[model samples]
Target: MEITLVEGDITAQRVDAIVNAANSSLLGGGGVDGAIHRKGGPAILEECRALRASRYRDGLPIGQAVATTGGNLPARWVIHTVGPVFSSGEDRSVLLRDCYANSLQVADVLAASSVAFPLISAGVYGWPVEDAVRQALTVLNAVDPAHVTEARLVLFGADTYTVAERVAAGFS
Candidate 1:
């Protein structure tokens, strides 16, 4: 896919799908999750609540992803994927990597031509910003361009934006 670094809020990006840096529970929490919930309104949470009541697991399997409506955001859909917490150890790297992979897979299945991604595992999840940016780019590079035409890494801060730009520079 064509990976690009853009400074903005992932929650407000107008893509076909936006990857949500969600906790395993998929319940609305802090950071990107909270922002998405806040913007998407209560309907998103209600949907999550109902989904949680069904067959949802507290811990999503690594490399797995699920879809939800955007609620109030401009995007049509939100793809929630669980990233490993910092405490999950070095193996968390692979899980973090899967966070991107599974998200793209979900986008492909949804026939999304474009998608936005936040630096999963970076904020409340405690992944180092630089490392997380690198991991995100690595996963993006592996995605088939045909499946996804455009991919934007939306950053809320200048530092995160710099990291994304640095990673994108290498990719380009």
Candidate 2:
């Protein structure tokens, strides 16, 4: 697969799907979750509320992902995944990897040819930026790339873009 690195908003990407670094509630929260919900409009929230009322009444489990209509966003669908809250003393990297892996799986089910990803858990979740970037690259690099042709690391700022570019350079 080809991984494109971009320094911009994930919400603005024109792709098959975009991953939201959401909270377990699946309702709109801060950072990427808030942006996707706000820009994607009510359809996304409607599906999420229905999800809560039915399948996800207890909230989405960490490392699990679900898909919903992209609504007004450019993408055909939105894949929501809750990244584990970062703990300095605990190794929650597996949960972080699951966010990407599971999102890709959902995209495949949707027959999405491309997907864009934000740095899951690196924002309000308080993950160290460098480690977050490394983990993302590692997971994406190991994947078979049969389903999705393109996976983009949509960086929201220059600092993280620089960081991502550096870490990704170490990969392909």
Candidate 3:
């Protein structure tokens, strides 16, 4: 798979799937979650609500993912994955890794050749941006190329853009 780093709004990406760093509730919280919700429109929340009503528990461990409509975003689908809060400890890394893994799995299942991701849990979740970038690249490298043809790390700021670029370059 090809990896790239770009500075922009993740919600605006034209990939087949765009990931949302969602809360366990899938109800929409701050940071990337809020932005996605805002751009995708209230219909996204309505779908999330329906999922919750159907007994979709928040027990989706960190790293696991579920699919939803893109709402008003350019992408066709939204993959909602719960990421561990940094204070959750080293065990959280496994969940974070699963977050990336499950995301790719969902993308493959959706036949999505291109996917865009925000730095999962790096914002209010307090994951260090540098470490998060490294971990993301590590996980991305582990994915089979047939599963995802293109992946882009969409960053909201210069610092995050720099970190993602450095980590992606290290893989080269």
| Candidate number achieving the greatest lDDT relative to the actual structure | 2
Tens digit per residue, CA lDDT, model 1, 78-171: 8888887776445578888888988898899899999999888888878888788888888888778556899988888888798777766776
Top candidate on TM-score is 2
| Candidate 3 C-alpha lDDT tens digits along 6-121 | 89999989999999999988889888999999989998999889888785854455677988999899999999999988974365777787888899899999989999999998
Per-model clash counts, in order, read 0, 0, 3
Full candidate order by lDDT, most accurate first:
2, 3, 1
Ranking by TM-score: 2, 3, 1
Candidate 1 regions with alpha-carbon error over 4 angstroms: 57-59, 87-89
Per-model lDDT: 0.84, 0.92, 0.87
lDDT of 2 by residue, 118-144 (tens): 999999999998899998988888886
Instruction: Write down the TM-score of every candidate.
Output: 0.91, 0.97, 0.93
In model 3, what lDDT does residue 128 have?
A: 88
What is candidate 3's local distance difference test score? 0.87
